[model samples]
Target: MEQWKDKVVVVTGGSAGFGKAIVDAFAAAGATVVSISRSPDEHGGNGERGNVFSVQADVTDDESVAAAVSQIIQQHERIDVWINNVGQSIRVAFEAATMEQYRQLMEINFYTAVRCSLAVLPHLEKSSGSIVQIGTLAARTGWKNIAPYVTSKHALSGFAHQLRIESPDNVHSLFVCPGPIRRDDAATRYKAQSNGLGDAASTPGAGVKISGLDPEWLARRIVTSIEKRQPELVVPAKARLLFSILQLSPRLGDWLLRKFAS
Candidate 1:
């Protein structure tokens, strides 16, 4: 990957999970990392590196997203990378899931990304920056009990596809579909190191152990793709083949998932 020295990177949902990993990766690559999330204090990047900033914002709210984006632009004057990582997952069955839960999931997983993209598109277009939306394997596959979560991701994936085609100049739009990652472990380590709060598995779909990839390694791949301006990427080599095969024959994929992945 090209050196990110002096670059400005903004990561939403940055207080935890893949968002936190992406922020730290960019910071380590020498970018000025802007951590945007509702709980900025939770993952406030320590000043030891003198390159990380935390901004409080609710991505699902357009005003909040716009305000946060404005603040970043005012402080840094340009954004080199904008990562949409805010999302939520619940494992309730389609009929069992409450209407409110479905709406909330859609807001968090899909609308938030749309709102953030609108907030930053002008700035990103100006600088020919990159936009990365964190996705999941569930986006392409069906989950027995997490219908809402899967549906929301499917919508987000479609939105990312549209954005890539519409974006002008070198303004690259990419989506990352990764499998389950061990968030609690990272959270414990981060807290112990006093760098920031670690990510915990809080969703209804939490403990389902699918094949997991290391966050650090996935972060490296994401950085490399962003630098190269690739349109989409899947973490871990296995995911690419699985995603392709699943895409071609979803019914068989769903059957296998129900038979074994459950």
Candidate 2:
């Protein structure tokens, strides 16, 4: 944490949820945190330390993302960590989901990270910085409904794996996979409308009984992981065991998932 003092960090979709938590945590740790989102800050300005900055940018638009990164670089001169945290999900079934919906999901969940990483790579290389990609348990396995969302997450996870191999030794790429974070209103609504499929609220752990994690706690863990330059992180600890079990015995895993789904 002490090492992060004066470091520059960028978080996309930092206006709310996990992104907001990450932004607040980094800013409190004395880092210059730049938050990019489609919405402007209602508070208008940085935190008390003047370390937090907000930039309104639609990450799906390449020019907007590029310009936002340019502004951050001009202000801070370098970026020590870039967190690609902007993502959205739809709870509709595969057959019910439109192709347009799938394309939109890809743009938000997969391509946003790709574009941001490309924009930040040069700065990361110069600073020996890291890129933390927010992944989900769905990336490891498919779940009921939300096929597009799950697929996009899988794509991002694959990208992160390849990125780790291609990126310079100094530039680290880390993937954080967490299961069923506590649902907000939008998520709750989506789950309610889902076609008898389980979601974060009704099935908080997917196939397990564990509750969702608090955003702040997850954010702190992410920051610590970044400091250590870990390759991958999975929340709740128990999920790691489940992930391994699924790999060794997918049939059993599927059975458990079905049981939970029921």
Candidate 3:
């Protein structure tokens, strides 16, 4: 908490989901939080700490994103940490989905992070701050349905790695990969987007055999990781074994998945 007392943190898509959880966590930790979302009205009131501010911006628009950064810098004078947490996911078979649909989802899930991160990077560099890129297990593992989301995350994972490799010692880019985040409507969140995938479409990660993580718990871990300057955070720690296996050999990874499924 003390670590963030004097810092200025900016979170994109902080109106809901993991983004909102992260905003609350940082505010509780005493950091001045700026939450930028499309519908800032829906973002509601500030946090209990009275340190949260909301900004409405279309993250995919270069000018909108730049203006939001300008506004934050003008008001706060500096940015100590910038978090790119805005993302959307959909469930559709690769064949059933169109290139246009894929592009649209990419705009929300991938390019939003790219734009927000690039816009705030100079200020973060000035403050020797950190950049947090929220990702999902989809970034590492290829699951049935949701090729667009999976491909976007894979790009994000690569981007985060490049950022970390290129960032100065004092600046850090943290990539977080977690399983399904528990949501109130988790059971049917993807009903309309399912494209006839049935029960699988109604579940997170297309009913991947994994537990949905509590968003609040994951947010807390993210806050601590920022303070520790951790490069990558994989929740349920044991999940890393699977990611490790996937990387070592695709054949072995498929065998393990098949074994686990059986």
For residue 89, model 2's alpha carbon misses the true position, in angstroms, by 1.5
Candidate 1 C-alpha lDDT tens digits along 129-158: 898889887777676566778889999999
* TM-score for each model: 0.85, 0.90, 0.94
Tens-place lDDT per residue, model 2, 1-262, is: 5799879999998877888899999987778898887855533543223778887788888898889888888878889999999998667767888899889999989999999999889999999999989989888877876788889999999999988999989999999998767757533456565647544433444334556688888888898898889999987677777678789999998877666553
Question: How high is the lDDT of residue 88 in model 1?
Answer: 72
- Ordering by TM-score: 3, 2, 1
Highest TM-score model number: 3
Candidates in order have lDDT scores of 0.76, 0.82, 0.85
Q: Model 1 residue 28 lDDT?
A: 84
Clash counts per candidate, in order, are 1, 0, 0
Better of 2 and 3 by TM-score: 3
lDDT of 1: 0.76
Cα deviation of 245, candidate 3, in Å: 1.5
Model 2 lDDT at residue 259? 62
Scored against the true structure, residue 170 in model 1 reaches a CA lDDT of 68
Query: Tens digits of per-residue lDDT for model 3 on 1-262?
Result: 7788879999888878888999999999999999988864666533223798888788989999999999989888999989988888888888887898789878887888888888888888899999999998889878777888898899999989989988777788999999889999987789888757767667876777778898999999999999889999997688789889998999998777655431
Ten-residue segment with the worst summed lDDT in candidate 2? 199-208
Our tally of clashes for model 1 stands at: 1
